[model samples]
Each structure stands twice: as structure tokens, then as C-alpha cells.
Target chain A: MQKNQSIEIGALLLEIGALLMSAGANTNRIRLTMRRIAKSYGYKAEYLITHRAIMLTLQNPNGDLAFNQVKQTYAQVPNFMMVSGISRLSWRIVDENLSVETVWQEIERLKLLPKYPRLIILATVALACAAFCRLGGGNFTEMLIVFLASFSGLFIKQELGKKKVNPYFGVFLASFITTMICGVIGIWYPFQHDNMAFVTSVLYLIPGIPLINSISDIMDGNSLNGIIRALNGVVISFAIASGLLIAILIFNAV
Target chain B: MDWIDFFEKWIWFGVAAIGFAILFNVPKRTLIPIFIMAALGGSVKLVLLHWGDSLVLGTLLGAVLIGFLSIYAAHFKHSPPFVFAIPAVIPMVPGSYAYYTMKGIIKLSNNSNTTDFVPLLNDTITNGFKTLFILMAIAIGVFAPMLLTRRDSAKQIKMPLLKQDKK
Candidate 1:
């Protein structure tokens, strides 16, 4: 019984970590990730992201009878706001009594998604380019061109939604799309030098993951962990910049 | 620069109010009231500046006051404080400033004719960060009161979970 409970707890932590990494709090990706994490813990966890705040409820097998008790318990956690959109992920661990090891394992499992790396890279590039375009007032035609490339990245991952394609290959295709689009924009666009617009719009893709995660880490009173997450955000931003720089250099050379 | 020029620039005050209201998803009913209030608030800053107050400080206070009033309106309707506060904040967002800074960098970089590209980018990003932080600080200040007043009641109310079936 204890072992089963431990496994469930591990699964819950894993889900929260994964949900946090996906950029944008209210997107389909975060929702899907949260659902998967909750299911792993065997608890009937549900969530809602409204204009005001993100709310969640967890129902253990004690049924609705114990729901109030669970709610009260969670209401006491001073740093609950730290979880924000990823609250479902964190709440599952708390409810199921999972350990750190279980959470770490699940975090590891998320890498299995195949296209994970590629998605990260592609998203970063697309965002950077979009920010640049918006800043430059690059015109509808320029935006349309950039959008075509970013959409290609999104399309590569779309099959993940359909389950017909492996996530790894999807990421690769997405990265290729990002590279192709950004490279073309750099060489062909008259306003190729405007990295700011590209970067700003790209900020949308910059994964609020780091921002929220760092904030959460601080709120949870774990400065080291929070700093690590903050650093991760910087690293991810650099990764995206590196990809954009490489694409631009290669495209310019050719 | 002249009165006509100055009057033209204030158009953004209205633009700011509307953009904030919509982005925060304010209900249609409250839009007009909030817009009027925001204009009033913006004008107050203008008046204060003419009287020799610091424009930035005056504007910051104006944003806070506007946020507080909007929250009060929300309170009157039994609406969530967060709901109203967001739109109230729209007028204060530094959208145009962020846009121009970013645009300058991209233009300079592409042309390769400017020695000041690096400085321009850094300055622009710094300004964007400062603006974002100020906005966030004001938001929290506005939101703090709501949390304190509603803490007990929020506990009693069972917020419906939208993704209930997912589990």
C-alpha cells in the first residue's frame, strides 16, 4: 500500500515540473500536462484559469466527504500563489504525500516526449523573430512571412496533439522550420538587423516557466532552487539566441 | 511640443485606458465608467504636472488611485477585485515605449551603420524591464487590499473547477 502511494506521489511531482516548463500559463500544453500529472497520482484533481486567478480542487478517494478537509489544508499553505498556473502539478504532490525522488523521476520522464528539445529551441527562435518583426513595423507582408515559419514549428508539434508523430521528430521539424524562417527573414528582409522586435515578441515564447518557477522557488523559501530556475530561464534564452544567431550567420553566408 | 502637439499626444491616454480595459477583460457594462474614470485620472496627472509635480511620480500615484477606485467599483458590483484592477491598469502600460526601443535596435542592427547598436538594445530592454516592474508593483499594491478583505469569504466560496473531468 505504501509503495503504491509512493509511486503515485512521484507521478504527481513529475507532472507539476513538466507543466511549469511549458511556456504560457493558460495554453493547451499546460492544461494537457496538468491533466496527465493528476491522473498519474490517482487523485481526481481539477483546475480552472480565470481572468482573476487560477483555482484548483483535488478529490481523494475519501470522496466529496473529505473534499472540504482537503481544501482547508491547502488554504493554509502561505505560498500557494507561487504555484499559480502550475498549481495543479504542485497540489497533486501535496495531496498524495509524494517524495522528492518521485517528483525527480517524473521530471526525467518528461524528456521522453521526443520533440521536447526541438520545441524549446523552435519556440525561442520564433518568439525572437516575432518580437523583431513587431518592433520594426516590418509590415503585414513581413509578419506573414515570419508567421509562416513559426507556424511550421507549431505544425511540427501539432501531430503530438494528434498522437500520430513522435515528439522528438516533431521538435526537429519545428527547429528546422524556425531556422528556415528566421534565416530567410535575416537575409531577405530589409529590416533584418532588428533583433529587438524579434526578441520582444519572442519574449512570449521565452517560457514564463523560468519567471514563475523562480518566483515559486522564492515563495516556497528555497532561494537556491529559485536561483537555479532563474538561471535556467537565462540559459534557455541564450539557447534561443544561439539558434537565431547561427541561423542568421548561416543564411547570410549562403 | 506646442499645445496642439501636446493635445495630440494625450490621445494615447484614451488608447491606454481602452487597451488596459480590454486586455484585463473588463465587462462591457463597466467599460464606460472605467474609461471616464481613467480619463479623469490621466487629466489629474496632467494638472499635477502643470503645478510643478514630477510627472513620473504623479502618474504613478494616479495609476494607484485609479486602480483603487476601479477595485471599489468591483466591490460595489460584488465582482472580483482582480477583474477590475487589470483594466484599470491598462492606461499605465508602457506599450509604445517598449515598441520604439525594440524597433530602434532592429533597425540599427540591420543597417550595420550604427556604432551605438549594443547600447540602444541594452537601454531599450532595461526600460522595458523597469516599466514592467513598476506596473507589477502597482498591481500588487492594488490587489493587496482585495486579498485581505476577501480572504475569509474566498475560503467559504467553492470556485468551480473548469477542468474537473480531466481527472
Candidate 2:
């Protein structure tokens, strides 16, 4: 019985650590939370976090290794609701002292929690991009153009994302599509700010979360992870610029 | 800038933040607070800009205020500070600077416009530096509040989150 519980606790710690990392929590918090959760169940846990991986070890009271794990968490996608749920979960486990079975079930429940419906996401994202254009000094008509441009771009992105397309390619395609749409509109009436609508329309794909996380990780002293995330942001930025540049070149040529 | 025009932009900033909330799939229960926080951050920046501060300084102040407030919201909402804070600052990100940098680079690469090379070079350099500094200011500003608050966990009842989970 003792040995089985020990194995269960080790697996649970690693699972939780990977989940937190994937959901976009910073490295410091992941380690801190993992330690707290392990301590509650009478194990001492140490963790090492990198941009692409989480490594942790569990030690029994006798100073023997309980278990060790190195988990690779995939690139992050913004899911604030999931992240918050996951963050609260460690504390809940400690506060209520949930058993291994209950905790396992809870983890499954968190993973299966439904994301936002597609229609709402589409509409709000379009509106949000439109609002960004308005904030960029776009008038009402230009905002509408931006709305349609983002609407189509986000639509293409969601469809492609469902097929498991690489995110960089997804961003590239979406920027290409949105800029093309904006390009068509500009020919009718030149944009006041020289591609203002075209630019703001694709602002939704700015990889804001990674940029924010990169800085937070640095501030929390995880400089390596921070630099890694910052590099990821740069790659995504390049994807977007290339896509938009292609569309602009095509418009100029035509 | 006119006060009425200034106030109108914050409303749009709120509208824009709604998109971020949607993109992140923020739970409906916390959506309104996120919008208000985003709006406040954007408006604060604008107000600072109107007062003749540099773009970096204005963004810093706005992000700092929003960062502190988002933590308070997270406490009341019982979620992580980041969940609220990340979405709230989306409006203030320097999207235009990035776009201009791309344009300038593309222009420079043509290698045929010597007459405009100086201006193109200036545009790229200024926009690139502007984007970097503004982003750094935002990052540091948002974090300052969190760092300052961590030292005072003795008032646990007042600041329940200061005690643990370092990030």
C-alpha cells in the first residue's frame, strides 16, 4: 500500500507540473506550486524548468528517490481560464487533502473543461480588431473594413488550427488572408494612415501572451526561459511580417 | 488633446479588450473587470501622453497602475494575477511600432531608393527602439507592484496572495 501511494504521488506531481507549464504559467510559480503540493503529501520535490520541458524529482523522507520525471510541455496557447483553474487546484488539493483518485479525476475534469464556442470567439475577435483600428485613429468605415478583415483572418486561423497546422504557418496564412482583404479595400479608397486598417486587422495575432510571459519570467529570475519565450515571440513576429509583406508586394504588383 | 476625444478612446480600448478576453477564453464571470482594467490602462497612457510624457513613460505608468489593480481583482476573483493582468494590458502593446519597422525594413531592402534611405533608416531605428523600450517599460512596470507587495505578507488577510507561489 505504501509503495503504490508513493508511485501515485510522484506521477501526480509530474502531471501537475507539465499541465501548469503548458497552460502558460511562469517557471517560478510552477516550481513553487509543485513544491507546496508535494510537501502536503509528505514528499520533498525539486523542479527544473526550461522553455520546452519540466524536470522534477520526488524524494521520500528517508532521502531515497521516490520518482523522477522529465516532461515536455508543448508550446503555449492562451487559455487563462484553464490556467486559473489549474493554479487554484494545487491549493485546493492541499486544503481539502483530496486523495489520489479524486485528484486524478479532478485533473481530468480540468483538461476536459470546454473552451469558448466558435461563434462567440469569431465575433468578439473581429470586433476587438475593429476596436484596435479605431484606437489607431481609424474612422467608422475603416473600422468596419478592419472588422471584416479580422473576421476572415480569424476564421481561417480557427479552421486551420483545427487541422493541427503549425501555429507559425497558421499565423502566416491568416496574415496573408487579412492583408489581402484589406488590400482590396485600399484600392477603392486609400487608407488614411497608409495600411492602417491592414495592419491593425492582424494585430489580434501579435503573440501578446508570449511577450508578456517572457518578461514576467525574466522579472521572476528565470532568465533562460524568459529568453526562450522572447525568441519564440520574435519568430512569430517574423512570420506575421513576412505574410503581410507578401500581400503588400502582390498588391503593388497588380 | 480634447478631454472629450481623450475619453472616447478609453471606451474603444475597453471594446478592444473584450476581444482579448474572447481570444483568451476568459470566463464570463470576470470579463467585465478585464475590460475595465484594459480601458483604464489605455486611458492612463493617453492621459500621460497628453501631459507630454514619452510613449515609454506613459505606457509604464499605465501598465503599473493596471498591474496593481489586476492583482486586487485577482484576489477578489480568486484567480491568478496573470489571468487578469495579461488581458488587461493587451490594448497598450505597440502594434504600430512593429508594423512600421516591418515597412521600413522592406523599404530598405529595395536597395534602389537612395534619396529616401536616411528617412527609412531613421524610421526603422526609431520604431525598433521605441518598441523595445515601451515593451521593457511595460514589463518592468507591471512587475514592480508584484515585487513590492511580496515583502509584506505579514498582512495576509489584506493580501492573501503575497505568501506563496512566487510568480
Candidate 3:
């Protein structure tokens, strides 16, 4: 194999490792995707992934080994767009036997694809919160209050997240603001179920996706990463409860 | 939960799933189908719960259906199974049960006058386990499909995973 070919393969493998990590792919799936991609290129690959980082080893020219470690800089948020995009790219690699240069360019394009607009996310989340309220059997009045609170809370979360705030702190702020809004509403108008508003307003903030992923990881025998992800979910739940507890104390609603 | 009100929740769960799909940045074209999958899972739960069944049973049944459906959706949408499976399982996350578990702990802490801790413990334990089991159900249900259909992924990648990934 040419020196240039080996270098390109190493770079491609590292970039894909980093992409899978940042895209919120679990450790097992990351290894699977990396292995498959490497094999398709007529190379061998191995990886050790934890919650915080990824260490990938690929066999290069002359049977030499190449190692790359990708440290996750940001928190993991599921972007199905990127997830699906990566999935398709791997398959395309197999189908076309594409050169490393073309595959790398495709990854760059996927990384640049814009996420859904911020306004759309906020509006939809608020409506989802109202849906939770209705699912909780709350009346229209309660659902409206939850809708407003969720809107403001998700807005704060999105803004603070962009400002590079710690993800946990963002969750805390969102839940606190949401529960506080419901608390104030409770003081103004006592409804049949004021507490449901408090519960459902922050329903949008639960780490459902991560929690499910964690369990899936464990079942796939990636227990270390799975346990870590589950612990992250527990911590997020605690942050939410702390915020809600503070609001409850302030309103003396408990 | 009467017939009318029970059916009403189907729409809400569908809407909630759309919010989740949006938040996750699923492709714009996949939103409507994701909503339907979520609502379908929720209705499965509703039917089971309507018969005075345990929430664990209902959630497990619902998740099983969602898990099976997510495979087809992933194939059709040209996305990974996790993308659809994760969001579809959202409507049955048992968030309220977990919240109640926490609230029960807080209530017990605040019980200066009340001597009865039994009910508090009961509330916390019952709800806490409900949350745990519901999560387990969702996990197992979603993964069962992937485990069974390893051949689906195996077809895409000709590499043999079992021989090398011993750990």
C-alpha cells in the first residue's frame, strides 16, 4: 500500500470515530460502524469507546498500526439527521467502494447540514408539553399554562446552550423556570390539578432518549458506556428535581 | 379513562412524539410518520391499561410493537434504527412516575408532624419501580428487534463482528 493511501485511511477512520461520538452514537454502534467501514476499505480496525472519549486503532500499510483518540468536547444530543446521514454514508462506502477523499467530503457535507430552525423546535416543544398536560388529564386551562411555561423554558435552554453553558445547568434553569411559572399560575388560579402543570411542563426536559439508549447499550454488552449514560440520565433527573423543589419551596405549594 | 377520553390521549402522544423527533432533528420528511409510530405505541399501552392491567404490562406491550415497527421505519427512512426507536419510545418514558418518586422522598423529608412514613415509602417504591421497569421494558422491547435482525445490518457490512469483537 502507498504511504498516502495509509495516511488517508487513518484520517478517515479518525474522522468517522469523532463523527460517531459527536453524533451521539453509542459505543457499540460506533465500533460496529467503524469496523464495517474499515473492512470495506480492505483494512482492519478496533476501538475502545467510553462515555467521555473514543480510542480507535486501525491497521495501516505494511501491517503497521495507527491509533487515534477523539475526546468529546460537547454534550451528546441525538441528531437523527446526522445519525441517519452517517448510516447512509457507511453503506455508500460499501456500494461504490468510494475513495477516501470522496467519503471524507461527504462527511464534511453532513456535518455542515443545518439543524431544524430554533423557532420550529421551540414551538413544537411547547405544543408537546401541552400534549403531555392533556395526556395527564389536565383541562384546557392547565394545558395552556403548561404550553406557555414550556415555551419560555425551552427558549432559555436553547439560548443558554448556544452560549456554551454546561448542559446540566441548562437543564436546571429550564426546569426551574418551567416549574416556577406553574407555581405562579397556581397562586393566581387554583385549578383542579395545578400540580399536573408543574409535572408536565418539565416533561419536555426528561432524558428519555439517552436513557433508552443506555439500556440498549447494556443489552448489547457495552455495559461501561451504558452505565455511564444511565448515570448521566440520573444526574439530569436530579438537576430537574432540584429545580422543581426550589420552586415548590418558594411557592409553598407542597 | 372512558372511551372518548382514552382515545383523546392518542393524539397527544402523537404530538409529543413529533416534538421529540423535531428536537432530535430527524429529517423533516420523517416527522409525520414518527408521530404515528409514537401514537401507535401509546395506543397499545392504552388498550392494555384499559383492562385494568399493570403499567409495566402495558408499556412492555407498547414498546414491543414500537420496536418491531421502528425497524421498518429505519429501513424506509434510510436512517439507523435508533433514530426512530428512541423517539418512538418517548411517549412511554414513565416521567411522571419518576417525578412522583422524587416528590415522595421530598414529602417524607418534610414530614415533621406526620408520623406515617409507610405511605411515603410506598409511593416512592411503587413509582420508582414503575419507572425502572418501564425503562427496562422499553429497552428490551426496542433491542429485541435489532438482536433478531442482526442479519439486516450483517447484509450491509460483510465483515464478521463476532470473530473480532470478543469483549
Q: Which candidate is the best by lDDT?
A: 2
Least well predicted 10-residue stretch by lDDT in candidate 2 chain A: A74-83
TM-score of chain A of each: 0.42, 0.94, 0.93
Candidate 1, which segments miss by more than 4 Å at Cα?
A1-136, A156-180, A185-189, A192-197, A200-204, A249-254, B1-167
Candidate 3 DockQ, CA atoms: 0.67
Each candidate's number of clashing pairs is 16, 0, 0
Better of 2 and 3 by TM-score: 2
lDDT of 1 by residue, A98-199 (tens): 565766664455433233244444543444344335433455555556655665655554555467554334444444456566556655665443433233
lDDT (tens digit, per residue) of candidate 3 on A40-104: 97777767777666666677635776544454533676777887888888988987898888998
lDDT value, candidate 3, whole model: 0.80
Question: Residue A154 in model 2: shift from native, Å?
Answer: 1.1
How close to the true structure is residue A37 of candidate 2, measured as C-alpha lDDT? Answer: 80
Who is ahead in lDDT, 1 or 3? 3
Model 2 over residues B30-96: C-alpha lDDT tens digits? 7888888988999889988878677999999888988888777776777777777777888888888
Among incorrect, acceptable, medium and high, the docking class of model 3 is medium
